[model samples]
Target: MIAANARIGVARSAYFPSLILTGNGGVEAATLADLFKWSSRAFLLGPLAGTALTVPIFDGGRRKGNLERANAIYEEDVALYRQKVLTAFREVEDNLSELRILRDQIKTQGEAVDASSKAQRISSVQYREGAINYLDVIDAQRTVLAAQRAAVQLAGAQAIATVNLVRALGGGWGNATSPDESTQSDKDALTP
Candidate 1:
């Protein structure tokens, strides 16, 4: 800004005062003030502020689509859980029934084994005394072997049923929020 009392001497010649002098200190000051004001208010010139214009996207349709997808997944997870629970109950029921049937079969096999053992003992004695042929002894031995095999098979079936029951009931308890957890959002992100 020019000061009224400030020197305005001309340097065009050794001695010359023909040049006119004028003070523009107030004019310079007003011009600077206007520049500052315009710069300060430039931010309010648009629909959204400058920072808001560049803000991360949050489209309404996109958000709605995401919510719909999440809801579908949550329903599906619930359905899966229901199915698993039903299957587990069915497995337990099936095992109980199978175990009961196998127990009956085992009792019958035990009686057969006992009867075969007695028959073989009698056949052995008769053979030794020459009352029965060796064929009787062979047949008795075969019957005992068959009875033992039957008992073993029944025991195996019982064990298999028990294992299946255990597997059907989820091995252990668990905890977690599935697709139904808090709203699906990018709220944790810095840009959000």
Candidate 2:
């Protein structure tokens, strides 16, 4: 954007007077002695030197077009930067929301697993006392197993959400370094 602004300045300057100074220097190489002795005097005696002052007489709106183009480029760059920032913010928000939902899911799933395990234990006791059939105990065992499996899967998903949140935040907290706190090696790693 700064470069684009500088280009705009250059484009605007096209409408102003331009002062151009030009000169050429050459050694008089008629002979080796003349080349060594007359080199200093050759530029003043043999070359043309001049200064030109030029104003934009007529260029058919070229300067105006260039200025407009430069301004457009700068605006485009600013819009692109804004879009990138907005995308980054949206990603962070999404990760945060996912993490929150997964946390609630894991918590509820843990409670469900606990409840199912308790139910299975009670069904086993009933079967042992001959008050319920073995099939009832088996059903309770299957329910407990399914609940435990779901809890484990929810935990896995929670872990995944945590990793994604770290990624959305631009990496793990351990990877961040403030300028004043950074080590020499860290600075060297960032130099490129």
Work out the TM-score per prediction: 0.56, 0.73
> Over 4 Å off in model 1, which ranges?
1-60, 171-192
Per-residue C-alpha lDDT of model 2 across residues 36-128, encoded as one tens digit per residue: 674445553222476677989999989889999999999998898899889889988988898888888888988998999999999999999
What are the per-residue Cα lDDT tens digits for candidate 1 across 134-169?
A: 999999999999999999999999988877777676
Q: CA lDDT of 138 in candidate 2?
A: 94
Worst 10 residues of 2 by lDDT: 38-47
Clashes of 2: 0
Clashing pairs in model 1, backbone N/Cα/C closer than 3 A: none
Candidate 1 overall Cα lDDT vs. reference? 0.68
Clashing pairs in 2: none
Q: Model 1 residue 119 lDDT?
A: 97
In model 2, how large is the Cα lDDT of residue 178?
Answer: 73
How many residue pairs clash in all the candidates, one count each? 0, 0
